[model samples]
Target: MPDLNPQTVAALLPATCRKVFVAYSGGLDSTVLLDLCVGLPAFAGKIVAVYVDHGLQAESAGWGEHCRRQAERLGVDFELLTVDARASNGESPEAAAREARYRALRQLLAVDDVILLAQHREDQMETLLLQLFRGAGVSGLAGMPIASAFGRGQLLRPLLEVAKVDIQRYAQTHGLHWVEDPSNQSSDFDRNYLRNEILPVLKQRWPALDKTVARSAKHCGDAAQMIEAWAEQTLPTVFDPTDGSFNIADLSAITATQLNCLLRYWLRRMGLKPPSQAVLQTLVEQLVCGRCDATAQVCIQGSIIRKYREKLYCIPEQCLQKEVQTNPWIQEQERIILSNGYVLSRSIASAGLSKNLWNNAEVTVEPRRGGEKLKLPGRAGHHFLKKLYQEAGVPPWERDIRPLIYLDGRLAAVAGLWVAEWAWLSEADGCYQLDWRASESM
Candidate 1:
């Protein structure tokens, strides 16, 4: 490949994107990108350099300062963001740092703003190999796209196809100084191990390994897109938007390969992490063949797959932790924050509970203590909360935190879902309607 220059890099910029922010890590790869952007007429007065300090290494702060000074030397705007990159329960340090870096960059970008990174052909090949080793399907094997919609903006990799040797040559030709992260030399991480040990040997055997591997990744990406299109066609048959769950019977009818594709696509749509193959297979088994009475569940990362009443739910574990404590209701307070991360509010309606009831009775919101029954309007007899939830198709996990509003120590309404017949206003002048807003659902 010809040496990457400012003109070649500028030619790769998308015509629709005017604002550009390069994720300048003060490393060789990013240094080349930053220098190219500084000289590009298209990026003139439209470029900003952002350095994220992951705070993983002791010298991260100093590195950030170096990047800021470099940005100043180039006469470009600069911003620094500090974040904690400590690994969580099931996350690796490298993954943690990467997640934190992108999240910080996202906050600095606006809706149409483009953030550029400096991943080259070799990096792409390494990612493909890593995903293959992990038994990833097409999505992972496809590697990174040049451009994609990201948080509030788009992420672009202008040098994704550029060779690492070309980048190094460009940096040296420009007499630019860049930082060399010590972590890159540490083979303790999987990617570093591949870079330090595996790729060199492979490249010696096959001089064009980077370009060839990239071609294979592109093929995988094409196949992935085709599979995604197929999955989109199958979605309408298996999805139930009414309750935000999948229809087990419909999903079970599909082949295992189809099921796996749909499952990954659905999880991605919901902004949840895709489960590993083992966890996904377990989820499929529970969803398709588990006993009707069984409450089969599989937890992956921070999300949980729950099967209830023949429907599969991708519930965030944080939602389940919202165990609301009993609290008295204040009519004067327009909005009440529930312990379960929901909000209860009072709205006036032409027809609802009698306004007189609000003034005459003291109301409080509390969690159901069990055996609580409500005589809903138009229903023959009072019914237990459990029976009502079951009949209404409410998941068992949600039953515990569902608010039960009381009027003068008597059950008045099942917050926003139903109101007791006794609490119903007669031919009164006005009425007060209860409105509940939960994070996921009522």
Candidate 2:
């Protein structure tokens, strides 16, 4: 029997978290979860069900309708969401279907709402094994969190410790009718292969296979937490604050394991799509481990991480409408205004003095280049842009894309590099510096 009885699940639900939405797919596991929810006191007046119709198999729509009908029979509110499951870039068809299904469900929930799923211990074992096969770190091996943030609300998997056979038994006990997905036995999907073949073989060898895998996943989860804590401390050391954001130098100093955690953590913090292990490793190896002067970039999600001039620059996938002032004196200089509320603007304000000085000045913005020398007003010597960056303590990777300022073919200011001694806004100086990049957020 599944230990995740309605009573056990009921005990874990907080008093305030009564409203719940079950991800019902007409499967036996989901059907049992629906039955369990109805019997729980925490779901007395607030239990809604959702059946996502991923137009994958020909009969998926019928299955969704069946789930809705079953929910009505159980006296639960039901909503059906239909989605087009499409995949690209070497993604599996099954994965695309699941992604579309979850994306539809994500849109249905409000920020304060909670979503329930029927992921069991077996699913956890499968997820961990898959992550391991893909060279994932501890966080991936940790298995899906029992409850984690998703979209605006939260996702809860109360059956993480329960067995699938128990869910089947529950359906049999209650005479609950559910649809059997033919794909589960088709041996086409990775999960199906594991469920029908690999898992049974492993279980036959070790009677407590599910339990052991779950334990291992939990251990990985704990170890991952410790590694994250260490990275938190190490990040600020190599990560520069000059741009009011984290720099890639911090990542360059990290080991592959640390790099993996930090990249995923950064993505989670920004609420962006995470890249696969291969993408991450390529980023580390090609971008971080490449030549100091080589321009390298790896686009993940909608953002591009580019290393140039020994510093890394993050830009949107689309060409952002930036404030670019065309100057007749210099063909290369394009005064870019950062009207976009980027974090770097805050760093510019820390220099004190008037507001929006960079906005007022027709700043000359151009890409950094070699052989570009800056001759300060009072300084007798001329300094190369590259050397100036090093002397200013900018990371080698950041110098290339830092956006050097050129006044009449003479370097005046670096967008994020440094304001030339001649261009610095002193106590008496009214001229300020800022990026002219427009808001692409819209």
Candidate 3:
């Protein structure tokens, strides 16, 4: 009976949203949804259909063309994006395709743009069951929300509560045509197997299975929101903004279940996926009970939760790789980009390295090599790089990746942190400052 309620859809969308982008695949759900959007007076002359081609199937290109033709028939704008959805290490092909599709869509959207996806009650029920089997917490059991923040924009699922049979009826009444993906029939994929072999059997046993499961999901969502509110109130008391790490000792005061909830809520707020139960337990054990000097790390699908110096940090696994590069300095070059995507720039300043000295030296930049030493401007003698990093409060993981600027075979500066005593200009000589900007990916 829901059948993509326009009143409910209107309430979910922002008043300022004039443009609507439908993630259309020329499939039944999307085709029906697109037709509904095209009929809405509020979205007149402002609807577009976007089809992403993952290039996994041989017929993907033909499907994209079909979607384009369908959009044209509906008198709406259309776009097709092609992406290589090849799975990386430790990533499944389905995950790769989904991520790639979202990434592509995100690039096409502006900050205020809204994208609509067509996933119905059956889809929601299946998601809940999948999360339950994986031993997920309240958040996962809640399934998908009606609306959520997408990359730099927003996403709306107007059909989330609508029944699949109602959508099929709408399509049939409208005399609509749509593509049927062959992959959906395969039992190799987990979702496909559940849809074909599991859900039907369950439905036979409980005729009202979809409605009851959806009701339970709604209850879980309400509880998850409460937990999120609690996390927002508690995070400030235990988080240290100065160094961007959590206070492990303070966190240890709470029960393990409370700790898990707090951690999952915090991670979700930060736009990062929380680790699985087993992985999160290991991480918490390392943080709450491990020795002060001991370092521990738990790698999840694409991220790593690390414990160091009695504080916890979450870093992407890709960032842990050593990205080192050496490049000869040019006098006129304003900025140098490192292998890790960090940017280093030279600027004239009142108090920095001597401009004349630097100009005369054969300058180069490289990542930190062991056994390096630097003399502070006010310190008595040169100190080991390891000791300097510790004194400066730099994490051990960041030390080796930071840039080292050398002037005529001697270390002149350590990024923007410090300039060597020998490189300090006299009162008469002009000075120059080095500015380093970390990668936006971090």
lDDT of 3 by residue, 336-436 (tens): 87766667898778888889888899999987779999998988988999999998777788787778889998999998889999898655438888987
TM-scores of all candidate predictions against the true structure: 0.91, 0.71, 0.86
> How far is 84's C-alpha from truth in model 3 (Å)?
2.9
Clashes of each: 0, 17, 0
lDDT of 2 by residue, 33-66 (tens): 8999999764766888898877778998899889
TM-score, structure 2 vs. true: 0.71
Question: Runs in model 3 with CA error above 4 Å?
Answer: 1-8, 57-62, 86-93, 241-243, 265-272, 294-296, 300-307, 315-326, 366-373, 425-430
- RMSD to native, candidate 2: 6.3
**Total clashes for model 2:** 17
For model 1, the local distance difference test gives 0.83
Ranking by lDDT: 1, 3, 2
lDDT of each: 0.83, 0.69, 0.83
Candidate achieving the largest lDDT: 1
Judged by whole-model lDDT over C-alpha atoms, candidate 2 comes out at: 0.69
Best by TM-score: 1
